[model samples]
Target: MAFQEETLNLQMKYFVLVKPSNSTPSCILSLSTIDNRDIYNNLCQTVHVYRSSPIHDSDSSFDIFHVLKEALSKALCYYYPLAGKLVESADDGKRRVHCNPNAENYGVPFLEATANCTLSSLHYLDNNDLEIAKYLVFDPQDKSYPLVFKVTKFLCGGFTIGMGVLHAVCDGFGASQFLKSIVELSRGRTEPSVIPVWERERLVGSITKQPFPKSPMNNVAFSPFLNETSSTVIKKYCFKVEGEMIRRLKMSLRKENENLGFTTFEALAGFVWRSRARALKLNNNGETMLSVLVGMRRNLKDFEPLPKGYYGNSCVDANLVLKVSELNERPLYEIVKLIKETKNVGSTSEYVKNSIDTWETNGKESLKMKSGGAVTVLTEWRHLGFLNENVEFGGNEVVNVVPAPCNLFASVDMSIFTSSNKFDDENDPSMKGGVNLFTSLPVDAMPRFKEEIESLRFLS
Candidate 1:
């Protein structure tokens, strides 16, 4: 939690503006309504870790900074919007990318930094403490740029690449695609495997003309505390849920009722949601909500598919509302089935279009979550290609991929990641085929929360 005994003594070496290698059209790109959410106004940071390579010690010919900077420039040729900065419209006050044709004005910030200690001394950055981890990423007060990159080299030849991209520009999947492109270019590829597409207009379907009903998203508050200045302190904990436990849970559910198919996500999310409610000991009369961020790429393919390389904020949060007593009373299978059904209904083309139309008609305020009630938001990142793709820079082995910590809402938020190559060891049975869950909850309830999760798994 304290970063370590040895001080990082990290110092900034230099900051350079990396522009696109080839000229791209200069125009103001209007972000889709889905991308204009107020919650996505800030940067979403992710740090990519790489261990020491032979090139770091013996090969003077290979320079990490030089290779990555050049690759970034080439990647920018395809992802030019990232080189541009976000600007507000004069009329609607909505944010949009302003691509300055002048190469001098539009460029992504590439920062170089150095740490006095080795990455292993920092435990390969497996900790969830933001106070220590924030140093590795670049998060500035002015978040106008669509993208920013920072590479910090350690004394032992290891390094971490910190990427900060505006969430409105893309979702986790889209960002992963951009990262793959950079990795490809850095590895001496002339072109990326997937071409980039920028057609935000396609997300804007026909506006809804019918009278809108009360949406469940309105009741799904992300935080129980309304004021950020409250004295409540929330802490984050990362737990590895073994594949055996997940399989057993699913098997138990099937034994009860074999009619429905249970996914790992549905089973785990249901368990965590129920576990949190029980741990918190919420009043039975009160309501609890579960919101899951569902990727709409496959759903859109059913009706008017987006381009192959189309990467934007193509995700919608599906909400499930239930009374606190009902959540505790219902069996795990019922909860899992409910979650599956919610996802099934939300993943349709009609639902996506209707969501878009609602946002377009009523604006972001319509989707704004109200304060009060217990809410837990779950998002699955295993299949997002961050671990599956070749995101390696200059053949460096990726050690870890982590979301940089930020001050978010007071409610519980869970990010699930499957076993990565870093932990995929044939000898280490405990580390294989399992999912790592990153959970943030109030510091007071964390002990009980862990107990509840363990009890559920063991009882199942």
Candidate 2:
């Protein structure tokens, strides 16, 4: 519906106590599969402790609707695709709207149409707890976004917010852009401090601009609402993984692969994806692919955080090749080696930016990928500054924050976000690594996956 309702004298709040900037701050965020209403409600509460607004001099200025709207707008700004400049179809006339010109104010009807298509799942909200209710305050309504955000009016004179943005939009670093922006906007700011740049053409336009990639955005091969109906039902579960555990895991893998040291993410992802592969027990010695999202922040050379600082999906996803059996049975270090080698070729932020063009010009179909095809994504967002426990709203607390699982067919998808439990070397372990997993296989998949993991236990 409306970004935020104005009736009932509604108001907005922030997790961070930022002053209303004259400009919109480019705050950002991302999510994992968190359909439970109670937890979602709790996340909506501002986790940051805010002092009395010196400017407001009174609480009258706080508008929940506006606050939530600010958050939604920034999130939207980050991944709206209106900003991406590649054309997937040719003059062959697939006759559809393409990404390159990110601005789509006229697509309001299209957004609403897509938004309305998701009415069926809305019932998931009817059963949420208060934590979930509060969480909905800033959630997004676009179903494509793994995160779900919605708005509901209350009889008492207010409304509820909902969001379910897919982690694909941007990772935690990107998400922070929106959060920062909303906080600034709520303070009554006008434009954003660091306006996000969606010039994908400049950053990563296709190598072949005349034609587009095979349109992953509009694949008829996959159904619009990718319900796991035909697949065996898989129950959802989550746990906080210690960063120390992750750090040690990386070190151990590195010791094994001294010549090709693996990053914490590669080691951990390789370990997990392989475990899941073993559980599948497929006969084919197929080539398994591990997808890692590469952030193009300042072209990877590590520029001072963009004067705009970590905004949107400045990422290029790449795959690592391994035998399915290797993924499941090989020493973690070997997998780490493979990951490092693949990444070593072109980690310059430059390649990440150029990939946009290469991908756009070459199209995904033209780029050959080795066949044995079991693709899994491996990434670590802990290093991205999401570890800061600066989220809160008024009296409410953000007990948790996670990105929903990306629904990929016949593919095992796993996303690991910075855990809320701190695990900084200096600070107490409040934030750890939280894993979000997804698959279209059977319900038996996960338990079996866990068993396969234990099969590779690294003995002391």
Candidate 3:
């Protein structure tokens, strides 16, 4: 009760500090929780997502602050862990993973630092400025997501919501749950048009139950051969990619061959693998490997869906191996076809088992090596976020989405998030979707990278 009072004071101070001015980036979200001592090590994952689409229909009316206030009030009513520092059995029956926050692998005692994931939507006179569409608050000054979201107000009146999500318990999906929950609370309608489910063990089972392997040799996640750079930089650029371009490449795949039979992701992922390989000059390279994350939820489709508001790493990796020259030499369609064949409907048990086998496998998996060819990874977080808009506040809705790339599992050299957005929403043409790209290279690489992107001839 006392902490609640303190939280209120913090909110008021923050609100006064971030008061809206014509130029200042305004505050759109603010809330706090008792800093759970066992948070960081206990947390399962941390991710920030953004969604934007042009507002098509008009109803230039909203009670943005009133809606957001109600939403936060409800989120505060339910105190939950951001990340579940877990300890459990390897076998099935929906058990927690055997983990120790203090253990070497897990690094026990999840941190309790308050975190935040801020989502601010800046308005433009025209849609030409898509590049600077959504500026997310990454690398928070608080060093956490929840802390950044201490105050909430809709900026530019009603078009966007800034969110600072805590990382200790939820991943992006969990954040969506909070959003949806708030939406329901604001409507004075407790019957969540869709309710959140939070049974962790049932969501993402133990690694022991479903293993995915991580090798040493080809994996770029941990290798000494990285270009001379800081560890922090390495972590960030671990996997830098262009989502819209990827979509374009994938759409090309579909247009080229109707029966090629592969998800756009599978097709273009191969192309990206080849592109990175070519860029890095690793063609015809020796044992080239890429691993893709597979969510066990669909694999276990026979079972009930994982609980809503579930925040755990619910997926594992699939090994994609190829000779770099062989991959590069083949037509894009052929490479994608191969990717399709490699697909497997894996489950938690399979993921846990494969991880054990792969960790024991002869080489490094997550490590990105100058010696190895390019690697391609996949994630369904973006795909799943399609429903985020279902959770809304007043007239505001989450329509488009972007996922932040963070150091995950200490294995992947390149972590890819499939940013999903629906462009046809006529009512909210105000939203435009684009990927929020993060890289591990020095800040200097950004200028050059931008130059390269600008220099690219899309027509050519």
Top candidate, metric lDDT = 1
User: For model 3, what is the alpha-carbon lDDT of residue 381?
Assistant: 54
**For model 2, how does the per-residue alpha-carbon lDDT over 93-113 read when each residue is reduced to its tens digit?**
111223322243211111110
Which segments of model 3 are wrong by more than 4 Å?
1-69, 76-79, 83-155, 158-168, 191-195, 203-226, 229-259, 282-288, 299-311, 345-374, 386-389, 397-400, 404-460
Structural RMSD, model 1: 3.1
- TM-scores for every candidate against the unseen true structure: 0.91, 0.58, 0.57
Indicate which candidate wins on TM-score. 1
Models ranked on lDDT = 1, 2, 3
Q: Quickly count the clashes in candidate 3.
A: 94
The whole-model lDDT of each prediction reads 0.75, 0.40, 0.40
lDDT of 3 by residue, 303-326 (tens): 556554444444445666777667
- Model 1, 203-313: lDDT tens per residue? 764557762454553333233332355465666676667667677777888987899797888988988888777765666776778888877777454668778898888
Clashes of each: 0, 98, 94
Clashes of 1: 0
